[model samples]
Target: MQQSIMSTLPLLLLLLFSSLFPAPSHAWGIHGHLIVCQIAQGRLSDAAAAAVRGLLPSYAGGNLSSLCSWADGVKLRYPWSAPLHYIDTPDHLCSYTYDRDCKDEDSFRGRCVAGAINNYTSQLLTYDATSPSTQYNLTQALLFLAHFVGDIHQPLHVGFTSDKGGNTIDVHWYTRKTVLHHVWDDNIIKTAENDYYGEGVAEFVDALMQNITGEWSQRVPGWEECSKNQTTCPDTYASESIAAACDWAYKDVTEDSLLEDAYFGSRLPVVNLRLAQGGVRLAATLNRIFS
Candidate 1:
């Protein structure tokens, strides 16, 4: 009995130590939570929805200025972000079929399985217009739908075989240990926590959207980029070590040097471009579902 107790003591102490140190923040939680709140507010009206969407670019430090503005700005008559024409049939879900090694861009069969999930949710929202469903309005359902679509656009969010969507790549941000996904989702955001998310993240996202909206402008080309870049995109991003990805993703902006650069200076324009697409798409989804 004494010997057994002695062995268990060390295990108990180790467990206690771990419990004392909470895991660092998860980026998905913060952003996803914010997305959910936006969708819920959108239920009011188009003006309400726009007002809600406005709040997103400015969310910060527990402030509600953006939220108040969004509530005021939503308009029922405003144009929806251009629909991804590729979503024509509404049955195709996977946008990155090419990411999985499918050679044909037109093949409906090769889309990433997650894209199917996206399509399904999108269809669900579309149909909700005529008839309503209780299960659909649940916070998780909204958050999952909103957040997953966002994830699909994040090049690294759909990781590779070796890294398993960056879950396997381990690295340290400051003194704490973290995986690649967590680093991208949380560490990067937390690193820039001081910048008012509404002002900073919103400004960054807005600029990205404006720049790409002028260039790509339409959802079809945006989807086409996903199709064309799928196979190479994941590997292209995974090509860097975990640390490099973090550094490249944030670079001069997240740090204190006050240096101004596109949020994605060292990386391919595709990442920021897609991020803008995802944000606008997310906003559009909210608009359509609530309109």
Candidate 2:
């Protein structure tokens, strides 16, 4: 009886911990991460694709999208990484600077989403097929880089500190009581999938792919380019996010504001554009890293 009681203690502690600190809401949700990674995998160069396939475990079947949300799932095990998913800027400032705003709640510098991108990009850069051992886990690094790239593009991920990037703001998403951050992360994308794509994520991806090759074709080159030929340009992406947050996301939004068709219709385009950019940029970064 003593042994059996001891054996169950770990499980009981886990349950208590979960109840005390529930999993924080993930940025972009699972489908959003899937959409970004799927688009990215489709755009990888031959060399990048080969490297990605070699790094991925057998269960993944060489599909990076299959594990795009792996980082979010491991948050409990990697408690320190929670801060790496978003940057909280000064309320109403509507601007982001790495030095000033990139710290976590503990004020540790270079600990935000943009910094995570740079850190993981550097880790993946050390990948070498010739080396039998590496100091870093390139597989985890690749996964982190891919996910952070997607996170930085979500406007509210770079949102105001006072509101915890809209996570604290109580709002009704078309009669459903939810936070504003979730409205962007999952609700909007889910609604788009349901209403326009017949609830098919693949169909939604198809439409974005078409737009990328069609209406947004010319902008693709610019999106994929990092200034000064850097491997990744997350700072630029974060800057764009805060601007979008101010101009679109936080605009006309307040505590308990009901958001419906008018809000959805106008903001869906921004969400789509950001997702497209995240995919394009992830591919570009991987191509540079593997090249």
Candidate 3:
């Protein structure tokens, strides 16, 4: 009887844990849509197969029906959010320290780091590649690559030192309980939904891609500079935080209340430009590898 009860404790704890944060419906199939769209744009021969590889079970089992189905009504219309899976744990978020070391004592942190690196590498490859044989894989990979690239750019993804990436900072978002990470992930972009979903999102991401060309070209050197310039890191991180604060405030107040607009508007051009540059570079990478 004692043994049985002890065994049941683990099961009970699992059940309780599961209930605390129910898996969101929108979470799974997002990566598939981003991948499919990019591949379709490239028109790769094996685009269909590659796009479906990491799709959610629902999408893979034919419940979703189409790749575009995944994007029908996602949060914030930030397509990049799909491929960049959310790290629910605070430990995971804070693991991305300046030194590339993860203090988290779990496999999730390792997986997250590897996933991020792989995503980055894939984009670099796709941007440089042009060969037909490798183009298909590169093209398909580019979509996933692009989406993931955007995810890393989100300051919250890197996280703060003490707050565990905003998870610990609990606050109310329009009278509803929310945290800093959620605000960054959904709120800031949500405020821009009207503008972001339409031509605005495309334009914003495009401009960013252009501005980051030189920095991205020498991504290694860029990070080295970033390390030396630690002060810039906090400031850059604060910019994102302030944008998030203004976004949460927007829902209640007039549009003018959203000060993030000025910053977002000013910064969007650079974002879009960098994305375009990354995409092109990603293609170039694939060409070189297979050529």
Candidate 4:
């Protein structure tokens, strides 16, 4: 009886843990979003900066990073939004087309991150200089933009549809068991926190914001195009993420593989690039909206 009871404990514990953390966590973890916001906040135009400060709720105290995780915070309560953080593509094709692939699991449709970004950006545009600070859904728009931009940059968030965006394919980060989606969402950012900065997340974000002093420090308002063509700007980001997901995030990963030195060595650079781009684009978007 004692042995049998002990044998059931691990399963019981696992069930309890699952209940506590029922959903796939936020993309890029807390640190990734914070770093993105802090970097963007540092680059804001003075008018854009002041406007952002005016729009935030009193609790956030004009600090954008403070509300970086708002979407994840409200996810459980608003189940309809669960699918808004990512888009899924069929296995190995590595492309995104809105006409076919933009719908989520819900038949209601158009709930994917790409769609949400476009919708929310339009919503933000509805607010103008004469609009009262709290006159519209400005806070929601800013919060959604801050979070979704980071989501679109995370490769696995736009990953394969067949394997449930790498949620089903299991792997290990060194010795611990984890799934591919999570490894990108949280592990890489957490590892970066512990290894590179060796400090608290806020401190790390501050350090990152301080270092954005190159050519793009004073980022302009409407320059999010990573491609030459002016159109397709939104889908272009989704497509880029899909390519990264197929080529890199899932590279060398398998059900039996242990992700370690070779995996981190090559892939961490991509993570940093996405983070930087997310930050720059987010800042530029806000500047366009407010300035």
On lDDT, the candidate that comes out on top is: 2
Model 2: residues with Cα > 4 Å off, grouped in runs: 1-22
Query: Which parts of model 1 are misplaced by more than 4 Å?
Result: 1-116, 119-123, 126-131, 134-140, 174-176, 190-265, 268-271, 285-291
Candidate 4 local lDDT, 17-47, one digit each (tens): 5456655584777778888888788878998
Give lDDT per model, in order.
Answer: 0.38, 0.89, 0.37, 0.75
Q: Tell me the TM-score of each prediction against the true structure.
A: 0.44, 0.92, 0.39, 0.83
User: Tens digits of per-residue lDDT for model 2 on 42-131?
Assistant: 999999998898777645677999878777766797889899999999999989899999999989999999999999999888888666
lDDT of each residue in 15-101, candidate 3, tens digit only: 345345434432212332332234323422243233333222222332112333222233234444332333222332323332243
Which pairs of residues have clashing backbones in candidate 4? none
Candidate 2 TM-score to native = 0.92
lDDT score of residue 171 within candidate 3: 55
Question: 1 or 3: which has the higher lDDT?
Answer: 1
Off by over 4 Å in 4: 1-23, 133-136, 202-212, 215-223, 226-232
Best by TM-score: 2
TM match of model 4 to true structure: 0.83
lDDT of 1 by residue, 46-155 (tens): 64344333322222322222222121111112112111111111111212333443212344443432543344455445334334344442222333445444444544
Q: Give the 10-residue window scoring lowest on summed lDDT in candidate 3.
A: 62-71
